[model samples]
Target: MTPLLNYIVSHTKLPEVSIKNTVELLNEDCTIPFISRYRKERTGNLDEVQIGDIVKFKEQFETLEKRKAAILKALEEQDALTSELKQKIEATQDLTTLEDLYLPFKKSRKTKAETARQNGLEPLAKIIMSQNVNDVESVAYKYVKGEIKSVEDALEGARHIISEWINELTDIRNNIRQQLERFAMISTKVVKAKADDENAQKFRDYFEWEEALSRIPSHRLLAILRAESEGFIKVKIEIDDEKALTKIEDRIMRSNNDCTEQIQIAIQDAYKRLLLPSLSNEALQNAKTKADEAAISVFAKNLKQLLLGSPLGEKRVLAIDPGFRTGCKVVCLDAQGGLLYNETIYPHPPKSDTIGAMKKISSLTEAYQIEAIAIGNGTASRETEAVIRKIHFKNDIQVFVVSEAGASIYSASKIARDEFPNYDVTVRGSVSIGRRLQDPLAELVKIDAKSIGVGQYQHDVDQTKLKKELDVVVESCVNAVGVNLNTASTSLLSYVSGIGPKLAENIVAYRDENGAFTSRNEVKKVPRLGGKAFEQGAAFLRIKEAKNPLDDSAVHPESYAIVEKMAKDLGKHVTDLIGNKDQLQNIDLKKYCTETVGLPTLQDIINELEKPGLDIREQAKVFTFNQNIKTINDLREGQLLPGIVNNITNFGCFVDVGIKESGLIHVSNLSDSFVKDVNEHVSLHQQVIVKVLDVDVPRKRIQLKLHK
Candidate 1:
């Protein structure tokens, strides 16, 4: 194992046996789902993320080992593989250092030294490098034969040979590169194009600036680099050559001799011709990579917050994806998120028919017995809600403004199109918006998480890394909220601990062939789902109406006997004792407290038994926007407006005030008193009451005050 991988395993407190078994399984080409399912006892139940980390670490280690072997072999072939050199190669941890050590021995393009050797000038070049010049011009004149015609020509040719030799000295090049890299400043400048040029305005603001490379933020650096590459700007890194030259010269000209001047000239030539371009390019590339890593980390963090946003729980809901001229698309979904009906309504004029729109919504609600309305917070949403509020119904129906950030992307996606072939794009989007309110996790997996736009610099980051991180987030969320065995879609089940696409499909196929799973043991009957697969996955697969109540909770099957023993000792039938709160409260929990059954587990069991099939989501709260308000113009100063916190960033919080656009409660305006972290005060999906502070109609910006 690599030291880095070893360190991670140790620090993460993952069991050594589990890590070893997982690594072996991964090495043998076992997929994460396969290994996690079929090798539960070997892996000690390590989830996909942990297994993935091990796989990545193992691959990196093997790659580094291969590189080390190649470097050693290349050095040996060049007859420069000294004992010290071999040790250095073996001991090096970083790829850069290993490459630096092997650089001089590695083959290069045809150079002056190789050409001079062919022309029989190597002997003279060597004598000059010894720095014991007898007579410089006389020594050069002796080589003035065939290719070396003139005395000046001979000296210049000899100088070229010596210069190539100096360049070959990796130590001298390394010294020069270090000095230049430290003192260099990257400067980017943009020039104005002709007034009529099509792309002039896009780059006008970045006309001139110089920044320390280390201090520049990743986003700004990437922006500047991209602009320069697009021909909108010019960029360069200016290095202090005099200082760099001094460092190089000092190393090469250690002892002052007759050939010191020649050596100095040779060193300077090497820097200008061979070293500067290569070193500068490398440094810039490294900077760009670092910037990308930083940006990707930020994006992953933001995506996590958005994905983990609290769900409103399962309820019958009416969803509306709003529009202006095209009107509003409405969808009605049952409590289980199955679509019941859909239609379009024009609540805003040009095409506005308020009475007809109201009637359509009322008819759908009455027919479906809808409990709530989940309106997409997109274009014309407020106008649509206004129509819904005006119509009175027998049941008290709540209204919620659901974030539709990626709803359009999902609607236009192949999955959505396939799921609802008969429906229009807008209607599909409304169905997605409604399903999100019922279960965010199930609906979100259909769209690319990056397109959801909850994260920062998501587009400008490393796409591969971002996808991996977001996939892990999805897996974690799915496992955290155990999957419903009978009802989960393949997309949802695919994220379960031990289930992949194939296994999920098999489960569905078995269900379709037979019927729903009545107990946890029924999962084993699925094709290719053996004993081990059942062990890893059964605990996380919830059965709402299983014969045994424990199957509905997170407690694994292995622990069922212990719980049954406890119930037997308590002088009650297992079912009666499980949910009997008075009996549970009176039983001394200490009697059940073993090494495995600690206070935490005991308490969890008690809670689970009391609320069998308990979902962690909060009960859906019913809220409605006032019909009197539709736009910023109708929002008066100091009037309290009920809003939902759509996004919380370090700078401020954004609240959706039952409008097409959301208003900002800037960090400074978030409260009557000082506030630091916005997350502490508000979270994603939280409901708040804020007063309108300022409005800019032309800019469509609304400032809000949370103090009220």
Candidate 2:
């Protein structure tokens, strides 16, 4: 605990007491969302990201300690655990340094050095390393016996042992690592045999590329590595041999003698055959780790933005999964996104039943009482939207062009299958499109974040790290926008603080067996939802029109007594105090302050009372792309077109300009000045107008600049 305390405090530079309390809570199995939201006083108002950092460092510290224990045990078994060595091993903070300290003790397949040591050449190697033995052949002759053919063979064995010794020197390896960190260059060359392959052309930019390993952008490095992995290129890291060798020789060679010359040969062998190769891989791996983190950060950010995108809010929707040759698949959904009707309509090419499609859509809108029409932004989407908008409906129906990025994936997922066993993929896909417009967060959680198409080189990054980060983002967003206890699916409820998949399923099963939860306390009746689970998860679950009015709010059950006291002082009932801004503002917050509850908690309570159970996202808006532009062929330079930002990365954001090829708004084109973060200028699903800068029709590329 002390090691973890110091590690988190040093890494995060957070308040010591706050970090200490937060670590204690984390060790107690409190979720980040729970600690950040409900336990604010204990955590000193740390947000989810800060708490998440503490969790990351805590896990890292645990992993380091485990490795240290394993290494220490292995050393003790090998009879190599000296007091000084044990102290060094225990005191090292990072895995790389700890592994470096344990490198010589690692058991591996027998090597040339081990063979030489078995032949009893270590003593002779030590004699040569002293650099005072001018008569090296005389010393080498003494070791020439049993597996040693001559003095030359014995000398070669001694050099091998000396090279191994040089390789094992921790200072020498650390020095080489430092040099590689500063000056290593990563280079890639095209695999001539695969140069002209069609699939390899996507990576042609990296065929002949060279960059300083320390300075390359994460995206570029990922691209180069991906190209190498796909057999399109060969990647290598290098530094000047003379510079590395000179640094090593200066540390080892003391005098110019025959022994010094032999030591020099061993040094060369150590640098080329052992140290350089090993350290170069370490540097590359470290760079890869950095790249994976950067890429995963980008992915997590995009996923969060996409998950929390604007919700149209429980409107009956008529959704269409558009297509050209196969015709459009349409489904009518209720306010709760339950599919009521599904059918196919041909509105575009090959079928060209535009009039019939419009008539069917108008009738469906009237029959199903749809308040909004959700059109999938996929094949022939504009054509479908055009057909739907042409109709003169009885009521105003808002038209939303929903991004169908992962709808297909979700439609085919087991969750979707389980939810709709009687329905097929197309019907499930249309339902997803409608539900997404109704509530993006609710529908998006059903699909894997990586499949949702809001990432940069997501497939090329570290998959395990990517999954962990994206899951955290999902859980954070799900809890930030409290779930409805009555309506939330198992997938959505699973992300609630402390309510994992099993508990969520149990809660759902309990709800089904009995009825809708009537109050916060009723959650305890669910099997296995003990005191800790209820304490951690209850605040994030909202119940509408519950028996207790506070049950529908973010005000946790434990704070109900305090709110009741505030209401009592106001001479009003708790129900009357809620949403009464005039009365809420008049209450003196400090009057309710106690040792357990502080001003922060009181303020949050007051804020929640004002707008209890309110969503943190905005209402979804209708967007329109240029009617004049339907395809890339219609695009022209300087043509201003309405676009939606569908994906964002560090380098730039891609905009859907009502075309098959989404235009790339390079970071340089995002602003007149330098753009450090593309998200600062735009977000996922943001509508903006842009001017087309270039259109490569043949290559299916479109470049755009933000129009002021």
lDDT of 2 by residue, 7-39 (tens): 999999999889999988988989998899888
The TM-score values for the models, in the order shown, are 0.81, 0.98
Model 1: per-residue Cα lDDT over 333-383, one tens digit each: 988888888887887878878888888888888899998899887877777
lDDT of each: 0.75, 0.92
Best by the lDDT measure: 2
Question: Candidate 1 at residue 572, lDDT?
Answer: 70
Point out where model 1 deviates above 4 Å: 1-62, 70-83, 108-128, 134-184, 194-205, 238-240, 256-258, 269-281, 577-614, 619-682, 686-708
Q: What is the lDDT of residue 489 in candidate 2?
A: 94
Q: What TM-score, to 2 decimals, does candidate 2 have?
A: 0.98
Q: In candidate 1, where is summed lDDT lowest over 10 consecutive residues?
A: 194-203
Best model number under TM-score: 2
Report, for all candidates in order, the number of backbone clashes. 0, 0
